[model samples]
Target: MATSYRVGIVGCGSIAQRHTKAYQSVPGFHLAAATEPNTETSRAFQETFAIPKMYADPIEMLQKESLDVVSICTWHGLHAPQTLMAAEHGARAVLCEKPMAVSLDEADQMIAACQASGTKLAIGHQRRFYPGWTEARRLISEGAVGKPTMVTGYVVDGLLNTGSHVIDGMRYVLGDPQPEWVMGAVERKTNRWERDVPIEDCCLGLTNFAGGAQALLQVDLTAYSSADHFTVQGSEGLLMVAPDSLRLISPDNSNGETLPTLWDTHTQSAAGSVGFESYFHIAYTAQAQGLRAWLDGEAGYRSEGTQTRHSVEIMMALYQSVREGEVMRLPLEEGAYPLSAMVAENKLPLRYPEKYDIRDPQRRTWIHREAYDRMRADGLSHPEIMATLFNK
Candidate 1:
């Protein structure tokens, strides 16, 4: 093998910047090239990172760059086609951002393309690399929580945004059990979009895992949004989990047990891991390190596509449940995104009528990015962030 491998980035947004820093932190990965259609954004990204080549055309970059690793950091709808393109271009591995794709069909296409091309496909559920999460998984499996019967995961934004992590995290702690069925509800009173894809205004559902445990999913269902959390209720105890923190509460102790975060567990070893940021910076590095080992012939990568496909299916099935007006079973028969279909059929007409994107600077409803960053650094949850924004 070569001493180092070439890595290309498909987008130059904030997430892509993080991915660039992570690739730089990990050994044996070089930031060889990148493509961004937005000229100003691409220039800013290139200014911050030392990527040698830039392309306005993604296809041009894919054709010209002999990249071994490709990071697909585009919008939700672009994931599958971009992933298939990367695979077709001989990239050995791809770490595409979450929600994977708009529908199970696109997800299937990505999985099949990668499988056929012999490329390692990993979905960006990097929270799987969180130390607290892994610890919770170990404890749950060893019965520390004892006979987990129910798990409740909550997130804001849309189901495909932070909700994907919530679903994947809940399953991860419970040892990635199979979800058998789901009954869901959604409210889309207006035309709402997240990162250029249609999304429900709010949604909630109950999914029965094949492992005798049930999970309640809440996505944008409340005004009080927090860091997406997974609370597991076992026979012996209850556990509350976030990407960076874990809490264990047993029968005798109401105070609960505090668990290690990256800050707690790897202070000495990971001083250098926080290259561009802290907190999640460590998690991203760990994920990249895991990817490195997996690419070097490890048995499994935690967020592989086939595994992530189940989570996507669960979400899709949830939407389908609302679309069909009944509970939905797994292996969803619907190939298109149900939410988008509803929008297309005018099943969800804009009651308020103006379109808005919560992440867009031009959109006033979206929290200001600077304030969002500042509050997050101050340890504010999503609920607090929104409350603060609304109070003003």
Candidate 2:
């Protein structure tokens, strides 16, 4: 019989629920506990999911439960600390939420803790597990697109908050090439919320990768629709993927005849069209499967922690560029700039809903203060953070 891995989840927030559902759908895994700081929320999560245990504190749950793996579903800032704690608790592996940490340093600490503890860590870049993305990566790796030259990613939201997915997804499809440098601009057009939050509403970044492939990313919260758009341009063809469809164009015709080029004569006609055979909203499901495979010692399973760390490094570089008002080189060194500097300099803006005030320390500190402190204490300095987070 295949051994059933015991799993515990920390943070009973919205995403945690999704993780619970995914676990339930997979075999050879058991959802042992769900923990949250708030007793009410924890209890509610337990009741809603029929989980066997619920704890008000994640640390307590980690110490008490005989879990083989723990899911760090806390706020964006708590990912690293909770993951470190999980590693220390003898868990075989940990699955953390995105962005890994607010700062590069924190991300490093989490990775180091896992490494030291002999526990595996996987970051939740669930989109990579999606069928469309999986297919796209397959095609790219098989040279379907032929030496990708450039990629354009548009994620209509803040860079740190939501842009991490776009950035990570880019790395996933591009074969995790080392970044050369980042040049970007950020904008915060509206301030309709509370004062203390430190997030940006829109950003545009240009990056050069080691393979000479250039990437352009645009993120905006003010976009007209709630859809994502991505395009990859290769030497021979172009590929476009969106929320609803995926299209591939290459330069060869079935009859071996040169096809008519549109727009630019230099562009060659491409071939091949593949669509989603079975329409399934399985992003979260695939993530769960990947997590299980990693814990089961399945070869070739990409750990989530690795992806999260890289995403953190890329975003940090972009943020650094925006702050310094110059192109920031890759592999940022330690103590480059404190998270406090980013907040104090007003380089990182907070974009909240109309109901919340950005100025409230408690409210604004979710992504900045709380997350940074946990990361810093874990022994991750800026450069170290970038190295670990971005290291492929």
Candidate 3:
């Protein structure tokens, strides 16, 4: 039997909970310690997970524990520094939450620190492990969908926070091709809850890849409802993976003959063919299993070096496009939107907005009015509409 690896978790947020669950689910892995800034929260997490040790500081946790790996589930801004600290302490591997860090320089520092220390880094893009998505890629590769030409997908959330997944997933499905240029538009239509937040609530972008493949991405935090829509359009067929189901439509009926319907007898003769519905739960479980395999080293997964750099590059490009009001090319120059620039400009609050002030009636009114206008434009106007409507 393989020796169980001792793991430490830093950060006690919701995502950390998921990581905790994943660790518990995987064999040859044991949750040994955890760290959080809040002493009470840290103690609570340790109690809840039956963790043997808890610390208010991650650096101290690393110093105290003999951990094989550490999962850095901290905020996007802190990912780099915390990851570097973890590596410096002799952790063999680090699994960091996505968006890697706020800037390329920070990402580079984290990567360099890990490389110098002989520690491996893995970015948490678990969606790549989803069964349906994996199956779709396999089918595309095997000529089930022919050559992929275009992809249309949207991640319904704020650009920096949730759009990271969409962008990462797109790259995964498209075989991680280098993007040549990107043009995007971001709209801050509502300032309802926290008018001071600087993050774009809605954004639409077009990406041109080096291989001639094109991608259309839409990300919004103010959606009326939640949705995960991914579609790949190939030369001879199309595949769509929605939040609940996977669908494939082919131009050739060679797979099997379709039955003629009385009301639409010409349906089968009209064109191609369609195939089965796949359950979401099955896909989710498959993703979990992939994480298990990666942790076990059953198969080599994409190194943290490539994934982190690519994700940060894409994010920076998106942000640049938004700021410059034009297309931004990749292979960003040395001075392009550095983290220092963001810090100097005081834009951190924009990316990580303060919680909405529910007690302030004026602020609530402003947010509601903005949401109402946005919803009305989207043809989903309703007084009782939840906050999700503006998210898509």
TM-score-wise, the better of 1 and 3 is: 1
Better of 1 and 2 by TM-score: 1
> Cα lDDT of model 2 overall?
0.67
lDDT (C-alpha, whole model) for all candidates: 0.83, 0.67, 0.64
lDDT of 2 at 162: 62
Off by over 4 Å in 1: 261-277, 363-392
- Winner on lDDT between 1 and 3 is 1
Candidate 3, residues 1-392: lDDT per residue as tens digits? Answer: 23788889999866787677666655567889998887778777888889988888898899989888898888666788888998999987888887676677778888899889977777876666554556566666686667788887665535555667777766777777888887776554333222122345466778888777778777653333223458888888787754334577786654532222121222122211323222322322343344445656665564355675876677677767766666888876643443234334553334223334322454555346576567656754222234354443
Candidate 3 ranges beyond 4 A from true positions: 189-198, 221-227, 242-245, 253-299, 303-305, 334-392
Backbone N/Cα/C clashes per model = 1, 27, 14
Model 2 segments more than 4 A misplaced: 189-197, 221-228, 242-245, 253-281, 334-340, 346-392
Error of 1 at 343 (Å): 2.2
lDDT of 2 by residue, 256-325 (tens): 3222212111111111121332222245566677777767777645535655666677777777787777
Displacement of residue 374 (Cα, Å) in model 3 is 12
Query: Candidate 1's C-alpha lDDT?
Result: 0.83
Top lDDT hit = 1
Alpha carbon deviation, residue 249, candidate 2 (Å): 2.3
Shift of residue 327 alpha carbon in model 2, Å: 1.5
